[model samples]
Target: MDQKIKSVFDLQQKYKFELRKTDSKTRIAKLKKLKQALESAEEEIYVALDKDLRKSKFETAVTELFFTYAEIDHAIKKLSGWMKPKSVGKTMSNLFAGNKIYYEPKGVCLIIAPWNYPLQLIMSPLISAIAAGNCAILKPSELSNSTASVIHKIISNTFEEREIACFEGDAETSTSLLKLPFDHIFFTGSTAIGKIVMEAAAKNLTSVTLELGGKSPAIIDDSCDLKKAAEKIAWGKLVNAGQTCIAPDYVLIDEKLEKEFVSHFTVAADKMFFNYGKINDEVFGKIISEKQFNRLDGLIKKAVIEGAILEFGGETNPESLTINPVVLTSVSAENSIMQEEIFGPVLPIIKYKNLQNAIDFVNSKDKPLALYIFSDSAKNQEKIINETSSGGTCVNDVLVHISNPNLPFGGVNSSGIGSSHGIFGFKNFSHERAVVFQSKFGMTKMIYPPYNLGLLKWLKKLM
Candidate 1:
């Protein structure tokens, strides 16, 4: 641990108590400053995201910048209500006592973000931390260096070091930060890295909220409108060139509709990405880096060698770090591509004989972060939802569930351990301290020590 980094941690530690005592007005004011800072840095954010991921201005604004703004606004609107102590229902044990769960700040917090959606992943948790009155330190991904630099500048200009700070570095920086004992840690990245974060936090028994990724599946029921389903999936999967955590990793559809679905998907993807028969460089984003491009390229090639058929879009331009949306068909369960979460613009469509088979196939893998179903049939939707487990689900749609701040965004088990967004995020950076005010004469006094066997029996019966 560098002395300067340790000093930063020390400053936050010393200031956590003061921060925790702040009123909702104070926290909301801080959030407002952050929102204003983001507004002032809008153009810089666009340029940074474009340089880092080749993201279009519209995409950057919609996915990253706007998301951070919305989260801050949501926190401002709901801060007072969220901060109030929640009263628990009356019970025998708590009779004559006021039991409330107080939302206390978790002191100092550490936020480790991923390269994809770098701004939102880092800022969303920071908004929650500030809303809950906790001091924080942010670690942005090194892969997205341009975006990271912009974030560091914004944070530096908008906040004091003790209240909020952003550190820009690689894995070594992350390892050093994990050595400290922060009250809570919020991480967003792959499951493998999430495990490392969890293991590090375990050393100090620090609480954690992991927003990790997994192989989220999309199911196309026979009853669904093939064109609509294809369009929705195409937009969701290709929005960030499929670098999204909850993007549909693979699709399961009936063999009968496979051909038609592929055709519709190709048209939808082309219309969205290609500008009237030509590659729309502005609308389409390039891969983040050559390293990532190579990984995706190799996956496509390996899948093909293993008998998977490339139905559409397999061309890659290494110089530009962009791979056209590749669609694979006849992909088996054992294909290497199927073994890992494909965090790229590649979509694999697997044909199933029946809905039950699709459900079974989804269940065979680790529970996904999201399970998307494309169907108008209430019966099918309900059945698929009930039979499958995921952190969240979208019916007849994709990716829009995250837009609702009222809903939590996260995963389950191997996918992730905790939740974020809205009140869920506030609670993630807070400790639900149990506070009880006992009345002068409480029923619990009857059970306090002494051999009152007869009285104990009577109290037990009463309880």
Candidate 2:
């Protein structure tokens, strides 16, 4: 094993017991310290994020820092109650026994976060791991080196290496870390890499929480407010340049509303970014890397070449690593843009005659991380909610569902596996142990191997 890997194992062994035995107060205190560290380093974090992804200060505050703080506060407030053993109802078989479920720590854990929303992804899961009384090794995506460096510095400064450590490297380093046996692994990235992480965890029989991404869709019905839907969809799609996992990848709209929806969406995009002619740098963000930019550019180019209408914005600036917010019409399911998750500012608007067509189209694809419906009709919402399955769903909104710490955020099947956020996150990092305290004269004694006629009669009567 590499020295770093060996060190991590040695530290985990040394600290696992202490972590598991940590009182609620100690855990809260640790969380508070982490919270304070983040506050003190807020400016540095903003700078790092801007350097890495060109995230504006306001966006950084809302998307990264504020979200993490909410998780911390939520964990701190709920940790005491979460740590207390829950009493369970007794069964007839344990008539004289007391039963309870204890939430125990899952020992050393690993959190592999992605570059998109880098800080929040890592810190949110780490908060739960800490609250659940587990030592952790956080591996931030190396693509966001500036943010990763800042995170490493803050965490190392606030926490002892054994208590919480940050590893920095590329895919090879992550592969090396995955070779070690961690009690649990929490991964957030593409489905392709999630598979690799799961396979590695299987080698050690490690429990895993994969927060992978797929092409989440947004359905707009005629009963809904078209302008409002366009605004929300545009906001969700343009934020982080639509690199977010749950951002609306495409729009499924009623065939009649297609022209109106595009017009409204164009207006909303222009108003949100205040860019009428050229791309605006202040409100918009650049792609994280040249490769990602090229990939997005290629998708847009192929869609246009295949005779799909570019409703608006297919301009790309290789030097700035930016692609203007794009809207496409006349897109088919087999179109290159529709074939994969478009983790960019490209939104394909597909026309459907009715609600069932929209639902059918979504179901035909791999289950998505999120399903969005922009309709005021309660009947439609209920029908869609019941018929389809996803990691999460939001009605009349986009991306805001993830802001609720009370809601468990994750994906299903190809989208993702396992949930996280607030108590769900705590449970993910914990093992619920069922405990039973038996009385000296337990009923089991009567049912022991030496069964007599009288005992058999009593057993039959009980049955």
Candidate 3:
């Protein structure tokens, strides 16, 4: 084999053994140290993410720091119970023996995170890996290099090289790492890139949990309160300049109430990020790069050419990668605006003649990572909850479904594969081995058939 491949294999073998060598208590203490380092580096992390994507201190704390700290804190509290082996009842055949299922940590897991919520994406899975007693290798996005560097410094200082390590490099380094064998791979990013991660892991038949993004839909029913829906949707759209994977990508509003909803949305936008709101700045977030900005720019161009009216931000600042909060109206399903995930702060209002049409629009897309339905009506809420399938759902709130640790965060279909978070997150890195114990019943000697056809017939009848 080539030298590079040899080196990767060596690292993988070494890490796998290291993973099995550490006890759960040691791993938990390592996580505590990492968490303390993160807390100590809070200011540095905030500034770094801001420099990378202009993320605001509030947004950083809410989306990145808060989430990372929450996961760490939750794991610290529950690791003992979560790490205990699960006992199972003995079956009829296993009546004489004890049977139990153990949650053994899979050796050496790899986590690849995206740029949007750089710190959280990387650290959250790292939390799961540590909680499950597995060694982890964190490969953060190079697009958010400043924050990646800060993460590197904190983790290196806090964690032992074997228990946890941050690998800093570009796409080549990440791709190279993927080629190495991993016991489990947890990736959070775009579906396109997720496919590559899946394919690489397949070579070794490594299991994976993909937390990917798609055009997650938001439906505003006529029964919805325009004020409440507008406020929640506006906050979802404007946060981090709408770069979140779970952020509402497009909207489905009742046609008769569309104008009222848009007006309320305008009011809410003015309230959330007006001239005095401090949301739009180098301190707040920006689009990740010129390439992504240009992509959103292209969609805006297409919308304008198709006669779509801009209700809010119509253009982008390419120099600094800042895109103003743009709301579009007079949008059609055929327009480019409705084509795919507009990952920036651009929300398109899709008018629907009926609530079912809104449901159809969401159902038409692949199962999303997250879906939001804003309605006070029990009937409408029940329809959405029963009719659609997504990784998670939020009622009357946008993107709050992910906030609950009771729910697993992931997607289905093209949006993503597998799930994580909470107990599910820790178990995703665990190998659940099945065991069966057999007991010799009263008739164990009856199986021996030594040229006795009549006796065998009697035994079968008795059984």
Q: How high is each candidate's TM-score?
A: 0.98, 0.98, 0.92
Please write out the lDDT profile of model 2 over residues 1-463, one tens digit for every residue: 3688669767986899988988999999999999999999999999999988899999999999999999999999999999999999976678889899999999999999999999999999999999999999989999999999999999999998888999899998898889989999999999999999999999999999999989999999989999999999999999999899999999999999999999999999988875667677887999999999999999999998987899998888899899999999999988999889999999999999889999999999999999999999999999899999989999999988899888999899999989999999999999999999998757877767766777777677786
RMSD for each of the candidates? 1.0, 1.4, 2.9
Candidate 3 residue pairs that clash: 54-284, 94-437, 313-326
TM-score of 1: 0.98
As a whole number from 0 to 100, the lDDT of residue 140 in candidate 2 is 96
The residue-by-residue lDDT of candidate 3 on 1-463, one tens digit each, is: 2354445445655766656556668767877887888999999998898788887788888888888888787877777888776777753334566577777888888899898889988888888887787777788899999998998898778866656777778888788788878889998888888999999999999999988888888888877778899999999988888889999988888888878888888788777676574444733467889889899888888987897888765656688787778888898888988878889888888899888888888887778877899889999999988998887889889888777666788898788887777888888988887765545453345456565677767756655
- The digit string of per-residue lDDT tens for model 1 on 1-463 reads 4677899999999999899999999999999999999999999999999999889999999999888898999999999999999999887877889999999999999999999998988999999999999999999999999999999999999999988888888898999999999999999999899999999999999999988888999999889999999999999999888899999999999889999999999999999999877668798888888899999999999999999999998888999998999899999999999999999999999999999999999999998999999998999999999999999999989999999999988899889988899999999999999999988867776678875888867777877
lDDT, candidate 2, equals 0.92
Q: What's the residue-level lDDT of 424 in candidate 3?
A: 82
Q: For each candidate, what is the lDDT?
A: 0.92, 0.92, 0.81
> How good is model 2 by TM-score?
0.98
